[model samples]
Target: MGHSNVSNFVLAVTVPLPSLLFYLSFVQKCDGDRWENEYWTWVCDWGRLHPLYLVNVLFFLNVDILFWVVGLVQQNVWLIDPYWTIIPVLIAHFYSAYPAAQYDLLRSRAALLLIWIWSARLTYNYFRRELWQWGKREDWRFTDIRRKDPRNWWWKSFFVCFVSQHTFLVGITLPFYSIFTNARPWNAWDGLAFLVCLSGITIAHVADTQLHSFVARNNILKDLGAPTEPLLNRGLWHYSRHPNYFGEQLFWWGLSLFSVNLGQSWAVVGTAINSACLAYTTVLVERKMVQEPSRADVYRQYQKSTSVLIPWFNRSTLVKSKTS
Candidate 1:
């Protein structure tokens, strides 16, 4: 292996070693009598059945349960938002480190590099939006839901915040599991997947940057006692009302292509579910937008001429035709 590949491999193997060792030690300490041996054997067998998934489940539960507890104590469920950008990168490395992992070296390296880039971009955007504040606030949707039922929010948030996100995070990352299991030589499909993944990352980065700038400028306008812009209709916003959402969906789908290349088509299930969720989220966001008195009418007009998710030609011409 080249120096770069060797370095990546070493990092991957070490990143998850502490957790793996702890788990093994616990298992060993528990093993003894017939019944205990049988239980441990069953657990080992389960791990053998799908080491990558089993490890991920353990990791997910550990991190998620902690997040759940912290959310309850802090009265804020925003912790997972930043981690959403992080978990996939960790999972990629975890998969790479698993003893049973068998992957084409180049393919694994490419996947890891792309995942790191994606994670960095998303993490940066998230922190920027938060103004580098940690746990300042939860998502608006979660806050709304909590306000609607403060009485039940405590228990409800367990399932709503942690459990649902567990499914989405693990499901959407199915491609990582698939990628690590296949040892097929890198080929044209790998190249195509790389391009798609890179394109998605680029699109998302640009759209998010544009949106961030708009928000920052609006804050300045508000501070100056000037009327803030009611809507962002420049850059990617001109092409699609939710270009960021589109870019996010594209990223997951592009990752799914890697699994498809390995004949693990089932991996697409996670990406599909994620897209469905994003579609629903888009609806809620637009509904919220239209509820704003200042922006309602203008946003409605913008919606008429702009695609909801995908980038496309402005439909202003069609709007004009209908009016005529």
Candidate 2:
């Protein structure tokens, strides 16, 4: 066969192989009785909770390694985009399935529902951009990074890109762990948290839809060799420069609310760290936009008139900016 055919075969097999194995391993790990009967019982007995934590870490690492290897083969560091949306779903499901010594079925189920909603919407938005096929364009941010350090990017990406994101994924799901561990019954706080999370999901969906529509229209113009439109400054974009990012931050903070209600102060640490990370990300994204020759002036103008994260009453500012 040709080299292309060989590459295609490897791509098809390698992509799913690790995931299948990880799922099987997760299944086996979940079988507590089997672990108890095995020679590893001593290790399992050392700490009832330690083994569970260890398995969680191992499974995540398994997926993380597979993603990293796939990135290497594809030469596309954006391969992890889908995982960012999917990991929370996996974490919520895992914890909801195996609750701790004290469990609240109602709260657990509610939290799981909210997570699924957010995951489904976010993952759909991601997949809508492109099929998970090989040879597609990498995310612009990753492309920029790779361009900056052409020689060292591959190795640097292993630690800097994949591992760092994997760490964040694991850390941000601490709320799920906190929820599953506590026996807190469904209360007004849970209701409010759910509402906030649901609102965040809806806001993010709208913001993404608006952005997508704008990009599509601009891409059509560009395809016709026409000048592209300036930065989107309507709808959600009119109120906040990064409404979708704000929605994402809102979603995590809402999740963190559950932990706050449970008096698990440590779990809120995840939310705080995640917020800081997002703040940094927002800065990077805005800087990138403002540096783009085409987008720079328009984005700078938009930034001047719009809030950075919070959506506020900015119609007057928007109108004034547009007229000027």
Candidate 3:
């Protein structure tokens, strides 16, 4: 751990072995601003969700606990440099530090920053919603977890919500974390890679914003007793059934690209892991919506009419209109 060039990738894989066992222990009742209370609230029963959701919740919980330790290490002892400096500095110093990668620091750093901004924005957006839910109740996602495993909520949550989410968060943030730990400067390739990362995040951001705005308007109409439908025929929604997830996926991939520019590491694995988690979310959405007969048909029709990832003007509709 002394040299910026070295890290225990093996430790990364093996350290969480006990977490894999995850025996559910004493869980506190929900109440207060303390960490355990928050965990309890997040882990409490929801009255819905499949067994797979419990697996995700457990994973999320376990990873979070690990991250808490990492966070503590970061605060007390200085192992890695702060991300803010690690990024631009490493890109600038790639040639002198890790020359094999060019130290193509500029392009790689750019990619890292792109992922940083986009991921942070999306995360904060959700954080804001969580705050808004304050004084109301915990997230429905947690409710689903708790409801599924009532007696084992204590130990189950210790593994699921506490450990798993933090774990994913660390994996997702590793590209930047590695840069911070390495402490080099930017290189020429870093700039190009950064630009590419920027482009993907920008595209994703616009698409997500458009889709969210559409949903907001639709919800308003529904409240007013006016007719409402999913906005699949227009805007970014015209392209993907899950535009936000698409953006989130791109954000992680952008970060992984930077890691590839750096050296041999598990950054690519991080991206793949993130994809698997999001895929789980996508499947849940599919299953839940399919439960409603009418909604399912509209969703199925939307699937047929839309492009999954690419956004277009739906020129086919335009061309048909002209011919008619």
Model 3 lDDT tens row, 162-182: 455445655565565445344
TM match of model 2 to true structure? 0.85
Q: How many residue pairs clash in each candidate?
A: 0, 0, 51
lDDT of 3 at 18: 46
Ranking of all predicted structures according to TM-score, beginning with the best and ending with the worst:
1, 2, 3
**Local distance difference test, each candidate:** 0.82, 0.75, 0.51
Candidate 1 residues lying further than 4 Å off, grouped into runs, are: 1-45, 317-324
lDDT per residue, candidate 1, 235-312, as tens digits?
Answer: 988999999888888888889999999999999998998888888999999999999999999999999899988999
- Give one digit per residue, the lDDT tens place, for model 2 in 141-221: 778889999898878878766777766877788888888888868899988988899989999999999998999899999
What global local distance difference test value does model 3 have?
A: 0.51
Off by over 4 Å in 2: 1-37, 40-43, 99-101, 131-135, 315-324
TM per candidate: 0.86, 0.85, 0.59
Top candidate when judged by lDDT against the true structure: 1
User: Which pairs of residues collide in model 2?
Assistant: none
